[model samples]
Target: MKTAIKICGISTLEALDAAIEARADFIGLVFFPPSPRHVDGHAASALAMRAADRIGRVGLFVDADDALIAEGIKAGRLEALQLHGEETPARVAQVKERFQLPVWKAVSVATSEDVTRAESYRDAADLILFDAKTPKDAALPGGMGLSFDWSLLDGWKGRPGWGLAGGLRVDNVAEAIVRTAAPLVDTSSGVESAPGVKDAGLISQFCRVARAA
Candidate 1:
């Protein structure tokens, strides 16, 4: 099967076009204000309209309230939500029930115990995303270009629909997929020229390599 690719943190029309043109299965829009890739509701709406149905629109949030999610859904016409916060399983269920959209809960993994925590969200989340753990006192939750050991997923058997994230780039993504057999992969800083600045060539290369892998 073809591995799905998600180019996260797309804020500009140029970046959006790159993801769509690259044949990315999912395009991520950050809703968290603290994130460098964050896009307001107005900008998101325009980007969504520009994308139309060519790519799957996903809104990334971190412990966002209902009003924020509601606004993002309406404006961006998001088809899925990626929660990368300290939200509980109950919150995931609540958001899924209220929004009626697929919810992907991102679990921070640094060790075997961290991988086990993902099982709790199997029933609540539609999909699970394993991301590298960030420092407790870090400024942002993710997108710091930090990566955990890929071998940590060698025998992963938590949930059915899951993906890999954190420091994935064109170079190591093929190796990552070969090792973990991840059905989906996500990237942000890895494909960026600078923080929050996406490179079209890198986006294209990432998709090509991931697809081949």
Candidate 2:
């Protein structure tokens, strides 16, 4: 099967189109206010409607409250939620059980030891995204455009599907795939022109590379 593609942090029409044209399997709309990629709930809902089943509508959030998560779900007919904050395993289970939507947990990886926790998440999450660990003082947890040691995933063979994210781009994505053999990959900052600004050309290039790989 072909590797799935997820283009995240979509905040514009052109960016949305680029992901669609690039044949992305999913498009992510961030709802966390601290992140530069944050989008209004209503806007995200509108965009997801426009997308209209062309791809999975992903709602990205931090350690948001139940009200916030509910709002996000109602905002868009989201197929999945990416918990990008410091959500515990119990919290993950609660969100999954409450929403009955498949949950994708984003785990920060800055070293090899981080890989071991992947399985614990696998039990609660339907999918696990390996992202770079952000600075402790960072305002937000993710979308930092950082890259961790991909070698940590060098021989990672675990249960549940996984995605490679953080600093993924047109140039390095193929190399990432070769190294991790990730069945799916997600990108946010990598395809952007600036903070919260997605570039269509980069989106197209990224999808092409992921598909080709």
Candidate 3:
């Protein structure tokens, strides 16, 4: 099977089109207010419309409330919701039931124990995203370009749908796939020339390498 690639934190038409033209499996739109990648509801809706279902459009949210999600849903036709906060299994189930959409729980993996915890989300979430844990003092939860030990995924299997994230770039993405056999790989800051600024060339190269891998 072909490895799925997600070019995340897209905030511009050029970046969105770049990911689409590069055959990205998913395009992420961040909704968090604190991050530089954050996009408002109106902009998100416009971007999502631009995608036009050619690629999956995922909405990234921190610990958001129902009102905020409702606004985002109204603005952006999100195909999936990525919970990137300290949401519990019950919360995941609640969001899935409430929105009747696929929910992806972002698990911060630092050790084998972190990987083990993903099992609890097997039944709750549609997809499990394994990301590197951020510092407690850090303002943002992810997109710091920090990576964990890919070898930690060896001999570990949890839910049916899963993806790899955190510090993934074109140069090392192939090695990551080879080591973990990850079906899906997500990158935010990897293809960016600056924070929230995506480089089309890098996006194309990342997609090429991931597909070839």
TM-score of each: 0.98, 0.96, 0.98
Best by lDDT: 1
TM-score of candidate 1 relative to the true fold? 0.98
Residue 23, model 2: lDDT of 94
RMSD of 2: 1.1
Candidate 1 Cα deviation (angstroms), residue 135? 1.1
Which window of ten consecutive residues has the lowest lDDT sum in model 3?
Answer: 151-160
Q: Native-vs-model 2 lDDT? A: 0.88
RMSD of 1: 0.8
**Each prediction's RMSD to truth:** 0.8, 1.1, 0.9
Tell how far residue 141 is off in model 3, in angstroms.
0.6
All candidates' lDDT scores?
0.94, 0.88, 0.92
List, residue by residue over 46-159, the lDDT tens digit for candidate 3. Answer: 898898979998889999998888787777788899999999999999999999889999999899899988888999999999999998899999999999998877756746
What tens digits encode model 1's per-residue C-alpha lDDT throughout 1-213? 789999999999999999999999999999999889999989999999999999999999999999999999999999999999999999999999999999999999999888888889989999999999999899898999989998888667847599999999999999999988899999999999999999999999999999998
What lDDT score goes with residue 91 in model 2?
94
